[model samples]
Target chain A: MKFKTFAMFVGPSVFLMLLFIAFPLVSVLLNSFQVTQPVFTTQEVETCSAGFLTQNCVTEVKTIPVLDENGDTVTTTEWVGFSSYANVLGGQRFVDAITSFDLGALLRIDFWRALRFTLTFTLITLPLVLGLGLAIAVVVNNATKAIKGPVIFVSLLPFIITPVIGGLSIRWLFYGDGIVTVWLEALFNTDLSIAANGWAIEFLMMFYRVWHVAPFAFVIFYAGLQTVNQDTLESAVIDGASRWERLRYVVIPHLMPLIVFITLIHLMDAYRAFEEVIAFSSESYRITLQYLTYDYLTPDDAGNRAISSASASAMLTMVGVVILLAAPLRRTWQEHRGR
Target chain B: MSDASLPRAMRQPLSLKLASNAFLLVWLLLAAFPLVWILAMSFKSPVDAFSSSAWEVLTGPRTLSDGNGVSIVDIVLGIALAWLAIKAATKLLMPMTVAEGTLHRIFNWAVVALGFGTLFVIGFFFFLPLVAAPLEGLLGPLGQPILGITTEHYQAVWVENAFYENFRNSLIVTVGVVTVSLTVGTLAGYGLARSGSTLAFWILIIALVFRALPHSVLVAGYLPVFINSAEILSPILGENAPTLYGQPLAVIAVLVSINQPFTIWMLRSFFQNIPVDLDESARVDGCTHFQAFRWVIMPVMWPGVITTGLFSFLLAYNDFLVTSLLLDASNQTMVPAIAGYFNRETTTTDQVEAVAAAVSITAPLFLLVMIFQRQIVSGLTAGAVKG
Candidate 1:
């Protein structure tokens, strides 16, 4: 009887999840494997190869074509399987576009540069956001009644403004002719074109992202901090522990679960960082995987499908790495909690 | 206890106090600087705003000549009024005369009025710009000279720019997406919550992993498949596929996919919060599983439904990337519409107009937040705390 009831309750969600979320993913997985077209013929290969490869050494390539509105002709084509993958890997496009376009060696250089940029952004912003959030939470937790309301309200204002508006505001603030840039230049006695350098762009993006996201972290941490056992802290104080010692020994350990939770969640959010980067920086600073995928998927691009799939696959691998690294920590936390 | 009689509670040294205060001051400045700068910039003209000397105004003494200076005026007036009221209350005792009583009553009413009035005025102006411009344009020659309070902006918004059409498209997309996602997600959440099976648990985890994939990446992948499917489905569906690409349906499909996991997560949490005893009682009373859920669980989860619905609604509304990618130029949402007006190589006037449009776009959202502030705050913080 209980089984029947539970089954009834679980049935609808299972069906919908399978239909909507799971189906598309399964389809993508299936499509990734299939050879969509016949391989390139020897005649065609010879015509294209010129002096690059030996004559009659035919490379089998599957072509995936994007059809136009009329569905008659192929608007664009991607040579799939090893050929496409080889193109991505071999710096062919980089060599071709280097003189005319500044698209650099995407596979070898751009990919790693973007990865490093994203990693640096995440590393700097994650700890800063966490630390700032925890500190704010501690202060708010300790604040007197008179000052609490205004402080909390002000602190929470960033949370209330949607990322779009907040990002735009940041963009306006740091744009070349804007106040922040001018002020920084004057103060530092040097030109600081925030948009010009990749590091500066990354830094600015991180600051905006942290500013927008920190309030959320602050509120969550504050809630978690409130649940911390006051007696534990008081006992630490009685035992002659300094404030830092008490925080380190009792509060930090207590906050570990929350820290992990927030970090994991924020890391996922950071990986998908798009709106702020798009709003704040030009396309040159497309230093994240998400931006790279977006660039590939832009309207006129021929490599939309393959590049998107490849980039998504890359992102999934990154997520897998994160999950692997965090799993042990998560298990330890869980065991500690259980104990 | 009196201030002198009360014991000092672990008094810190002056240096420590100073250091702490300095730290707090720096943080406060960091938090307040952007907002204060924007508030200041809003009053200044384009030239004055872009001037290098404007940064000095931040540190220097308050001056009206800095800008139109309404913000300063309001702040000063508020402080002075507060100070005066405090002085009057502390200095005086009984209401001896009609004048004193009237003054006190007026002051009391002023305070109350100011508190609510400020909120009201802010809301009014926010909405005013959005509506007034287009209305003034529609008013035509009679709307000549573009009065400071004119509805020219509203007219421009509506008739001149097809703002209403875009708004309609947005409305269709937002409503469709929210309704579809809510229906689908709520059912899914119920299933996940009720199912004791490990399969359900793993499926839930998979759903979350899918959700965690950056939206841009998903949308990037989604565009090709959707476009291809639309092509294939066109012969059968007929008129649907062509419309699907840049239409509200595209927005709805993308948003529903993006939002389903969050809805499931939130709804599952809400459903789990409800006691199992309610289900048992319902069952004992001869209600079937569906009936029990309908009568008992659904009502209890209404707040969750509303919260999730609002979130999905906001997500759909605030979204730009998917909307920009999927929708045609004519079918743009207000955010993208404003963004379009200020892309690379935009003119100064274009930037201002874009800002005006942006201000228009966000105004309604701000109003919605204010009206539903309680629900929003609770919904936002619900994930953090148990109760």
Candidate 2:
């Protein structure tokens, strides 16, 4: 009776998720293998052929041999093997797209450059965000109510503002007519253009990303800090441990699981950096996989489907690798918690 | 602890407490600087704002140059005389402290009064330019008449001058996406929680991992599928493919895919908190599983449902990337719409208008947060701490 009741309770939800979320994903996976059918009709094809051969023949081709209701087709053809997968892997359009980018001498220089930029951006921002977030969390956690209430709200304000607003505000700060530019020009008695250089652009990008994402890390870390037993910290302090010593011996070890969780989450998010970068810079600095994918799938491009699929495939492979590496960390984490 | 043993305020070792306060102050300044600067800038005239010296900009210049190469200095001298008069008046009226008996209580009251007074004065000064300029423009004989008291900048948004259609489109898309994603997410979350097993646990983890995948990758993967199938699905949709592309459904579909994982995970956590004993008791009372869930668990999980709904709503409303990518040019969200206002060729009025639009776009989210601030903070912190 209990088993029957349990099944009934869980049934609808399980069924709906499988149908909508899981099914569409699986369908995409399957469709990626199959060559998509061309939308053009037989008469359209015959008219093109007739233009080359004989003009009068185009009119006679009204009922030009075409696919019937069943699978029989005199004109329409379906190719169904590993052809779709093979075409993607062959790097035909992929090679052309990479070579067209013309970054430097290397054959896949664009892809490599994007990869390099993404990794550096992630590395630079992740530590700063986590460090600042942890510090803010600890401070806010210990503050008096008078200070804490307002401080908590202010700390969390950036997270509430959409990234577009955050990015626009930063852009305004650095623009030629902006306050920062005006202030800098006056202070130094010289013109400075941070946007013109690659390093500065990447730095600004990282700063904006960190500004928007740090609040997330702060909230998570704050919550994790709350879970740490006060007794452990008190005991450590009574034993004559310094603040840094207590942090190292007690808090760090306790927050390790959460740190790992947030790091992995942020790493994945950073890799997919799209909107902020797009808003910050023009095409010259568009060197991320997400931008590459956007460039490929843009409506004007005819070969969008193939190149975008290849890029998506590349992203999936990278994510798979990250997950594989984190597997052991996750295992040890679960084991530690179990103990 | 002895009073002598206790560290004196002046001689106390530079403790973490002191360092933390300093650190938090710096961070708070960093966070608040742009907001305060922009608010100040909104009040300053364009010429004064572009001035080279911060001292001159913060305090009006001692002398002014007209574009015609004329100088004006008496205005500065008159302002200085007025400042002296005001200072003398303040010194005469303001008391140092109240008397010491019941006057001690009066001293505290005086301090509070002074603090509030200072805030009121500063706020009035900050907003005075924004208020006075428009009024002066309207009242002047030669100047073009304007209707509003504040800057005409906000007219673009209030009137929906540029992207009014886009604003409506965003609202429709946000509402549709939130409604669908929350409904599906809630059900999926309940399922995962009730059917607890190793496989169920693994699936939950997979959902979370999928949620963690970069939004761009998911969009990339989903685009080919959505675009190609649009024509095929058009008949079912009762519209043409292009018509559907920028419509609310497209945004809703993408949001549903992206947000389902979060909805499920949050719901599962909420469900797990419900005791198995309740389910067993329901079964013993001859209620079917569906009836037990509907009658028992659903009421208890209402808060979780609402929290999930609000989160999904905010995600949909605030999203810029997916909406920008999938939605058509005509179907811009508020974020993108306001962004477009700034990207336009800026006139003095237009620039102000852009700032107004930005403030308007963010105002709703701010109001929502203020109203449900407690629920949201708890909901956000719950996932991190409990999960």
CA displacement after TM-score superposition, residue B199 of candidate 1 (Å): 2.4
How accurate locally, in lDDT, is each candidate?
0.63, 0.63
Error of 2 at B109 (Å): 35
Off by over 4 Å in 2: A1-109, A185-190, A301-339, B1-15, B36-150, B160-164, B221-225, B228-230, B234-243, B342-352
DockQ for every model comes to 0.28, 0.29
How far residue B261's Cα lies from its native spot in candidate 1, in Å, is: 1.5
**Cα deviation of A27, candidate 2, in Å:** 5.7
Candidate 2 lDDT over A1-339, as tens digits, reads 345544454445455445545664555455445554434444533343435555644443343434567754333224445554444333465566556764453324455556667778878899998998898888887666587667767766667776666666666566655677777787899887876767767877888888777877877887788778777877776797877787788988898877877787778778777667655754476467666556545555553344334444445434544664477558745965585
**Every candidate's TM-score, chain A alone:** 0.74, 0.70
Q: Fraction of native contacts in model 2?
A: 0.27
Alpha-carbon interface RMSD for all candidates, in angstroms? 3.8, 4.3
Which lDDT tens digits does candidate 1 get at residues B100-166?
A: 3333654665565456557545645574445545655676654333111122334555688777777
Model 2 residue B357 CA deviation in Å: 2.7
